[model samples]
Target chain A: MVKCGLEIHQQLATKKLFCECNSELSEEILYKFERVLRPTQSELGEIDRAALEESLKKRRFIYEVTPNSCLVEADEEPPHELNREALEIALKIALMLHAKIVDEIHVMRKIVIDGSNTSGFQRTALIAVDGYIDTFFGRVRIPTICLEEEAARKIEEKDGGVVYRLDRLGIPLVEISTSPDMKNGEQVKEVAERI
Target chain B: MDTLRSKHIYKVKILSPNMEVEPGDLVEVKTKKGTFRGILMPKHEFSDENIIVLKLDNGYNIGLIPEEIKCIKKGIRRKKKSLYKFEKKDLPQISIISTGGTIASYIDYKTGAVHPALTAEDLIFSAPEIEEEANIKAFVLFNILSEDMNPLYWIQLARKIKDELKESHGVVIPHGTDTMSYTSAALSFMFSKLSGPVILVGAQRSSDRPSSDAYMNLISAVRVAKSDLGEVAVVMHATTSDDHCFIHRGTRVRKMHTSRRDAFKSVNSQPLGEVRGNKVIFYEGYRKVEEDVELYDKLDEKVSLIYYYPGMSGELMTRMLEGMDGAIIMGTGLGHISNEMIPLLKDFIRDGGVVGMSSQCIHGRVNLNVYSTGRKLKKIGVIPLEDMLPEVAYVKLMWLLGNFERDEVIKLLPQNLRGEISARRMIIW
Candidate 1:
C-alpha cells in the first residue's frame, strides 16, 4: 500500500489571532511603517545560527491597514493573552479528530519567511496528538493538531497605488497533520476534507 | 557523584558569561509559585535573573524564585554539543542573487524549534519539484527584506546573474514581494535586452507551512528558467486557482495584494506568457533571446515615490522631491491631484527632479490633460506615464537616474521602455 501524510492549514475568521486588531485593508497606511525581525538565541547558549541567517535576509514588512482591518496584528503590539475564542475553536477541531488534549496550553514559535508576519515567526501550539479520524476507506491516525497565525493577504502589486494590505495576519489557523498512510491522491484529498 | 540527590535548595541564576556556577551546584531561590525542582542549563545569557532556570526531561525551560523553597537536585552534568554545523556544497555552476527575503528554512522535528535553513540542499528539498527542470547550482548573495532593498542590491544581483550566465542555464531569485516588483523592473532596465529568462519568484506563504506556495512558485520559476524564453521576467501565479501561472515582464509587473496567491500581475499590459501543466507557453509579442547578453547593473537608490491626495501638503511632496534624483507621483483620479500640490511638483521638476505621473486607479492610463489639475501638472514638467504602474515608474526612475541625467529621464519617462507604458489604453466597452 502507498503511504502518505498530510498537513492542512486553514485560516480563521478573526482579524487577528490572539489580539484585538481590526483585520482590514488600507494602502495609504501600509507605506508609512516598517519592521525588522531578530532571532532570539536558542536555549543551547549558542546563537540560533539559522535564525540569524534568516534574519539577514531581513524582509521589510509593509502592511496595508484599513480602518476596519486595523487591529492588534497590524499595530504589532504585544499579543493579548491568547484569544480564548481561537483556542476554543481549535480545541473543538482537535476533539472532532478524537485526539488527546494537553492540560496546559502553551504557545510556541513557528518561523516564517513571507512579509505577512511582522514578528518573522507565527506563534503556534500543539493542542492535540495521537488521535485518529475515520474515512470511508479506513481509519487514519492524526499525528498533530496545531493552531497558528495566518499570513497577510497579498494586495495587487501594480502602479498608481501598490496595495500591500495585512488585514489577515494573526487570524487563527487550524492545522492538522496526518500519518503517512494514504495510498493515493484521492485518499489525501479525502482526509483533507475530513480534517 | 550523585550530588543532585541532595534536597538542599541552591538558588542559582542563569547567566551567560563571566558568572560562575559549578556543574553540581544546587541553585534555587524562588519561583512564581511555592517552589520547583531541577539542575542548571549549561550556558546562559547575562540577562537571566533570580529565577533559577531548569531543564525538564521533555526539554522545556522553567524559572523558579528563591522563595519558592524549591530544592535543587543537581543531576549528572552532560557536556553540551557544539550546536553548530558548517558545511559547504560544490553547488552546480549556478548563481544565487538576493534582492531580499529568505528562500528556505529547516524546522527541528524533535523540539518544535524553527530556524532558517538556507543551504542549496534546503532550496532543493523545499521544492523537490525543481529537480525536474534544470540542474541548479545555488548560492545566497545577500539576505535583506524587500523594502530595505535599494539600487545596491539590484546592481549586486544583476552582477551575480551575469556571472552565472556562462556556466549555468538560467538564474533563480527567491525574493520578497514588497519590493520585488521594483527590483524586477530594475533588472528589466539593467538587462534592457537579455538572452535568457531571469525569473524572479517569491511566495506569500512561508516555505515551512504545508499550504505554502513556495514549491509551486519555485517549480514554475525553474520551468521559466529552463524555458527557451530569453528575457527578464517575474513568474508568479496567474490566479488564486493555482491552475495556471503567468510570466510578467520585469518592467511591467506589480504586487497587487498583501497576501493572496494571485498577488502578482502585469499592470496595464498582458503577461509575457502562461504556464499550464508542465508546459511553458509564450504568447506572441515576447522578445527572443540572442547569443550574446549585455548586462547593466547600475541603479540610483535615492529615487522616491510620492502620492498626490486631497489636502496633501506640497511640503511633504517637496521633501520627497527635493534632493531626490527622480520621483513617481501616484496621482489620484485620472492623473489629477490638488492644484495646491503643484508648486512643489514644479519646484521638484525645476530643481532637476524627474517627475512622472501615474494614475492611482491602477487600471487606467494617466491623462494629464483631462482635467485642469492634470493640465497644470503636465505644464509643471510632470511626464504622464501613460499606463505604467507606480512600481514600474519607481524602477524605471532608478534606472534612469543611473543611465541618464534628470532631463533625459523626463524625456524617457513617457517613451515606452520594455513595454512599461502601453501604446493604447485597452479600454473595455
Candidate 2:
C-alpha cells in the first residue's frame, strides 16, 4: 500500500516574476538592509494557526541585495505586472499535458513567515488543474500546476538570525504537483519526467 | 401632504405624473415590457432622467421606462443588522468626520444601493474595535470625491476641524484618496497649529470587499487621533499587507501608487510615526500637541498647476497661466523648462503672476543653482520649493495669495511653513 506523489519545481529562464529585474545573480553586493517579517491573515481575515505560531517567534531577517534585485525584492515597491514569458511557459506546459487552464488566473499571495520573502508572502498563480500523466505502472493524476516566485536564497544563519539574498527572491518557478496515485518511487520519477 | 412622496429626487415623466413614488417606496409597476414589483431605488446622478430604477427582492437592480406605477407601501422599513452599540465609557473622546468616500459606505439591504455612512455609529459599526478605544462623535462635511476637492471646501473643512478640536480629543477625517494628499496638504498649510491630531484616512478598496483596508485604516486612524501628535497627517496602510498603518505628515506625504493599499508614502521624508495594534508609536521630527490652535483658513482659488513638458509652446504656457494669481510648474530635473518658455514665465511673473518651481521627480529637492536654465528661472522670480511636492506647492501658493499681500507672499513662498519645505533632503525612491 505504497502511495506516492511528485512535486517538481523548475525555474523559468525569464525576468523576475513581478519586476524587470534580471534572473541572473551578481558577484558584488549592491546593498544590505535589515527588516522584520510577520505573518499576515488570509483574505477571509482568518490567520493560519501555523503562521500565527511562527510570527510569535519574532525573527529579524537581513537581506543582502544584489543587482539582480530592485525595489520590488526589497519590499519597497509594489509589484508590477506578472512576467509574460514565465506565464507562457507554464501555459505551454499545461496545454501539452492536456490540463484545463483556469478561466481566470488568480495570482494569490501565500503567507510565508520564514523571512525568505521580503514581502512576507510568496506570490503564486494556478495555471491549470485536473490533468493526468500515464506512467508504465499506473495513471498519475496531475492535480495542479502553479507559477510561483522563488524564495530568497538563504546565505547563512548568525546569532539565531537568518540572512537571505534578494537575487533569487523573485525568479519565476513552475511547480507541477501530482495526486497520490503512483505506487512506487520509479513510477513517480517516470511521471515527473512526462510532466 | 404625504411625508415621503415629495422627498424623492426622481421626477420621471413616464411614471404616472399624479403618482409620485419616492425612493425606498415598495411599488408594483406595470410597463409595456412586464409587471415589476420592487423597492424604488434612489436616483443616481448618472442614470437617465426619464427612467426609474428598482431593486428586486433578488438583490439585483433594474432600470425601466415605466408606463404606470402603484405604491404598495409608503416606505420600506429596513431591518438593521447587528451593529456595534456604543456604551458610555471614559475613553478618549474622538470625532469622526465623514467626507463621503468608499471608506464610509454600506449596502442598503432594502434598495441594494450603497449609501455613504455619515455618522460615528456607522464608523464604529464597521470597525467595532474603536468602540472600546474611543468615545466617538461624528458629522459629515460634504459628499464629494476628493478629485472634486477645491480650495473653498478646504477653508470650510479647516474651520470645521478647528471647531471639532476644541471639544474632541482629536478629529478623524475619512476622505477620498484621489486627492486626499492635496486636501491634507491644503489643511496642513491652512491650520498653522492644532490642539490635537487631525488624521485623514481613506481606503484603496471599498468597504464591501473582504480585503478592503477600510475598517483597519479607520481603527488605526482612531488610535492615531488619540495619540500625542498635533499635525494634520494621513494614516494609511504602511505596507500592502494588513500589518500596520503609517502616520504620514500632511505636508510630506504623497499618493505614490494609484490603488495599492500602501499608496500614500512620506516622500522626501520619513513618516512621522506608525500605528501598530493598540500601541501608537511616534518617531522623531514631528510636532506635538500645542496649547492653543492657530487658525488661518483663507485660500486663493485662482491658482493653477501646470506640468512643463519638452517643446511646450509659449502660447500654451501663457494660456495656462493667463488668469491664475499663482502657478506651480512641475518642471524637469533641477526644475527647468525650455529656455524659450522661461521668458514667458518671466512675463507671467512680471504681470502679477507668482510662479513657483517644483520638480516632477517627486522625491528630491528642487535645486535651481546647479544648471544655467534653473538660474535663469530663479532670476525670473520662479520660487524653488525644495523637496515640496508639486501639488503641495500649488496649494501652498494658493494659501499664501489668500492670506498675505503680494510682497509678503513673494517673501514667504520658499520659507518653511507647516513643514512643507524640509530643510534637508533625503535619498528616497
Candidate 3:
C-alpha cells in the first residue's frame, strides 16, 4: 500500500511570463554570461530555508543566451509586466477546478539557487486554493494551484558548475498540487489522468 | 454635567435619570427614528452639547441626540500590544521634527480619519526602541498634509532645523511621503553647510498598523541621524521586507511608486547608505559633517514648472511662461519641445524669463547636443540641466532665482550644486 500525491506542471501557450520574449527554444547561442548568486531576505525578514541550503554549496552558474533573450534574461534589467494571456489561462484552469480564487494575486519570490534562476529566486503567485475532484476510489483534494515562471533548462556541466540556457527561464508554468490522500498508486494515476 | 467627570463635555440634562455613561462604554440608544447600538465616544470640545458621537459597526462614526438609551455596559477591552521595546541609555542627541504624515498620525475615531495625533514625546515613546537609538527631542511644526506643503513652509522648517541642530547632534524629520522629495531638495539647496545630518523620513502606512513601515523607518532614521554625515537624506525601506532602510540623497531621490514601502528611490545615483540591524552602512559617495550651516533659505515663489505636451497651443505655452520670473520645462526625450514652441521660448528668454530644460523621462541626463530640436532649444538660450530630476531642477531654479541675480541664475542652472547632477554617464541603475 502506498500513499500518493500528484504535482502537475503544465506549460502555458503564451509569451514568457514576464518579459515579451517568445516561447520558442533555440539551440543557437548568441551570447553567454556567468553569475554568482546570493540569497535575499524574505518578507518575514529571514532567509528562506531552502535558499540557505543552496547558498551553502557556494557554486557559480553560466547561462547561454538565445536571440529571444534580452537584458531581463541576463538580470541586467527588471522584469516587465506579467503576460495577461498567461494569467487568463491560469485563471480559467482554476475556475474549472472549482477552486476558490484569491481576491488579490500577490507575486512572491521563492528562492532557488541551483543555477536555474539568475536572481536566485523564482517568481510565483497563488491563483486558487481548496478544491477537490471526485474519483471512484475517493475524493482527491487540490490544496493549491499556482502560476510561476519555469526554471532555466539545464545543459552540460563545466568545471563543477551547471550551465543553463536562457530560452526557458521566463516561460509561464502552472502548478497543480494535490493532497497525499490517495491510498494507492492506481488512484493517484487516475486523479492525474482525469485532472 | 458632572464637573468631576471631566470627560463629559455634554450637559446632564441630555442623559436619562440615574444613568452613568462613559466613553468606551457599549450602549443601545433609541430615538424617534429608530434604535442604534454602538460604543460611546468622547465628546470633542467643539461638538454641540446635545449631540453624542458613536462609532458604528461599519467603521463609521455617527452623531445623534437620542430620545432613550439602555445598557451602559462595558465593551470588549483591547490591550494595545507594544511592537518593540528597549531600555533607555546614553545616546547621541537627535531632534525629530514631525510635519504630519502617516508616521506620527493616528486614526481620529471621531471622524473615522487619520489625524496628526502624537506630540514629540508621544512619537518617541510609540516605539520605545527609537529612544534607545537616540536621545530624541521631538517637535511637531505643523499637522498639514504633504500636498499643502509650500516653499514658505520649507523656509520655516529650515529655520527650525538650524535652531535644533545647534543643540542636537542631528535632526530627523517625519514628513508626508507625497512631495517629500521636493521638500528634501528644497532643504538641501537652502543649507550649504551643516553641523550634522538632516534626515527626512515618512511611512506609507499608519503607525497603528501592525505592518506599518513607520517603526522600522523611525528607528533607522534615528540611527542614521546619529551618523557622521552632514547632508540632507531621505530614509525609507530598502525592500518591502522589514530588513533595513536605504539612505537616499535629498537631491537625487524620488518617490517612484505610489504606496510601496520602498517607494523612495535614488533616481540616477545609488543611495548614500543603508541601516541594518545595529549597523549604519555607508556607501561610496556621501558627504561628511561640516562646521556649521550656511543657510540660504530664500525662494522666489514666481518660478513655475511647465511640462510640454504634444499639440500644445502657442497661447498655452505663452500663458505658462508669462508673468513668471523663470520657468523649468519638462521636455520630451533629449529635452525637446515642438519646433513651434522653441520660437516662443526664445522670445521668453529674450525678455529675461530664464528657462531651464529638464527631461520628462525621469532617468538619464538631458543631452541637447544629440538632437536637432534640442540644439535649437540650446541656441535659443534654454539651459539644459544634466541628469537632474525634473522636480529637483524645478526646486533648484526657485532657490537660485531667490538667492542670486538674473545672470547668476542662468549661469548656475547648468552647473551642479548639492549633488543634483551626476558627472559621469552610467549604464546601470
Candidate 4:
C-alpha cells in the first residue's frame, strides 16, 4: 500500500471561518441555538458510520454565538457568501502546492464526532486536486485539495452548549492528507513540510 | 488493545453503608496511586472477587480491588431544580447583545461536558449578581468566544449598545478573557462618547467549576455598569486570590495568562477603580460620561497586528500592510526594531497606513527616543503607544479610523483615551 497522506490547517484571515461573525470566546452569553440530529437521506440511502453513531446517541447541540460572533453558526442564514478572502488564500496555498485548482467550488459536509463542529459536520469543499511538490530526494505527489470550516474550539464540558473556544471556530483551515509512500518518519516530516 | 483486556482489576470492599456504590450514583473512589471519581456502572459478574466498576469521566471503566480498597464516599448529589422564578421587572429597557462565551454555561449530561446554558433565565440564573443592580433586557447577538471575536461583532455590539444607552442605565457585556481586551478596546472606540458605562466582564474559570469567577465578575460588572463611569471598561479579578476586582479601561487591558483568576491587567496604566464587595471605588481619573454622547459605530476591519521578532523580514510587514488600513507592531525592548526594516516602516506610514508600536515585554512604556531604532521608527512616523497593550492599540486604531482620517489617526494614536496610553513612564527598566 502506497499510503501517503497530507495533514494541514490554515487560518482563514477573514473575521471568521465562513461568516462576518467574529469568532471568539467569552463568558457573556450571546445568542443560544438548540439543535437536534435529523439524518440526511444519502443517495445510496446508507448512512455513514460516524453519522449513524452520532444519530444513535441522540445528542443535542446548543451552539452559542457572541455579539461579535453571531448567528452564522445556526445555518439559519447562509454564510455571507463564502469569505472570498479565505477562498483566495486557499487557492494561493493550493497553487503553491502545485495542485490544479478546480474551476468551480462546491461546499460539502464532512461528519465530525468529537463535537468540535457545532453543525455535527464540517462544511468542506475541494478547491484543487492532483498536485506535486519538489523535494531534495524526489518528487512528492500531492493528492486532493480541501477547504474546510474549522471546528468550534472546546471550552468546557458542561450540560447544554459544550463551551467551545470560538477563537478557532470558522477560521478557515486547509487539510491535506497524503499517501503512505514514505518508509520512515523523516520522509513523512519532509513531505509534511513541503506541502 | 492488550492494555484494555489486562486492565488492573483492584478488589474494592465497600466497608460502610456511607460507601455504598449504587448502579448509577456518582462516587469518589480512592486508590493507592490516585483518586478517581465517576458514576458507578455495575459490579463485574465474571470476577470471583468483589470488585466495583466505575465509568470514568473519560468513558473508561476501572475495577477496584475489594480487599485492598480503603474507602468510598457517595458524592453529594444535588437534584438540579430550576433556581429561577420568571419575574419580569419593569426596569428601564437595556439591550444585552450577548456575544457568546461562558456567561450562559452549565455542565452537560449526555456527553458529560460543559456548554453554554443560554436561556435568558439561564443567563440571569448563572449570575444572580445582576439582580442587585438593574432589570435586564437581553439580545443574544451571537454565540462566540472572544478569540474568534472580529470587527463585525464589535460593530454590531456597538450598534446594540448605542441603541440601549439611550434608554438603559448601563450595558453589561459578558465576554471571554482571551480577547476581551480587544473587544473592549474596539467598543471603547466605536462608542467614543458612550454616556452610560459599557462594562465587558469575563470569568477565568467556567461557571460550573467551584472556583469559577463568573459570579463575582458579573456582580462587579453590574455595579460598574450602574456607576458614574461612562466608558468601555473590563471588570475582572484584580488578583489571583480573587479578594478584589478591578475595572480596566477598555483600551488598556490584556489577558496576561491562559488560566488565572486575575488574568486581565491594565497594560502600562492603572485601572480606573477596584470593586471590593459591591462598591466600585474609583482610584484613578477617567473620562466623565458626557451628555448627548456621540456614538461612533464603525470599524475598519482590515487592520492586522504584526508582532515583530528578532530577524523578522520586511516582506512580512509589507505583505500585511499592502492593502491594510492600520497596523499595530508589538515591537521589542523600548519599542526597537531591526533598522533594516525602517524604510518599509516609513513607506508604510507614508502610504497612509497607520503603524503604532507597543512593547512585547508588556510591562513598561515604549520610548523610541532612547535608541537609534526608536529614532528610526519615530522618523518613520511610527507612533509609539507608550504603555497600551497590543490588543488595545489595535482596537484604538480601528476606532480612530472609523471616525477620523488617516492623518488624524496618526496624530491621535498616542493621545490618551480611557487611560489607554500613559503620559509618563513608570521607569521599570
Q: What is the DockQ of each candidate?
A: 0.04, 0.03, 0.03, 0.01
> TM per model?
0.62, 0.65, 0.62, 0.55
How many angstroms is residue B157 displaced in model 4 relative to the true structure, after the best TM-score fit? 0.6
lDDT of 4 by residue, B1-429 (tens): 111122233354464445545555676766543455666654444434555665555344445543222234443432443233323466443345566676545433322224554545445645543554667665556667666888888878888787778877788887766778888888877665867888898876555433356767887887788777878889998864345899988887888766556778776677889998777899878777778567777777768888888878888868878888888988898897788788887887777778889988888888899988888788878888888887778878877887788778878888876667667766552
- Which CAPRI category fits model 4? incorrect
> Which scores better on lDDT, 2 or 3?
2
What would the per-residue lDDT of candidate 2 be over residues B122-144, giving only the tens digit for each residue? Answer: 45445554667888776667777
Worst 10 residues of 4 chain A by lDDT: A38-47
Report, in order, each candidate's fnat.
0.00, 0.00, 0.00, 0.00
DockQ score of the complex predicted as candidate 1: 0.04
Per-residue lDDT tens digits of candidate 1, residues B23-86?
A: 3334453433333344444323321345444433433334333444333443443232211122
Per-residue lDDT of candidate 3, residues A1-195 (tens digit): 678888999988798999989987889898776654533222222334565446534656778999877766665455787899999999988888888765445454565767787766677877776778888898888978889999888998877468899998889999999988899877877888887
lDDT of 1 at B98: 39
Ranking by TM-score: 2, 3, 1, 4
- For A1-195, candidate 2 gives per-residue lDDT tens digits of 999888889998899999999888766687777655533222223335565446545656778889788878877556889999899999999987778775446565565767898766678877776778877997788867889999999999888478899889999999988888989889977886776
- Clashes in model 3: which pairs? B1-B12
Determine the backbone clash count of candidate 2. Answer: 0
What lDDT tens digits, residue by residue, belong to model 4 across residues A1-195? 344555666565566757787645556666554433333222113335565445535544555555555445543333556777778888888889878664345554454545566444577777766677766656667666677777775656665435454445676777775544565566677877766
Best by lDDT: 2
TM-score of chain B of 1: 0.78
Clashing pairs in 2: none
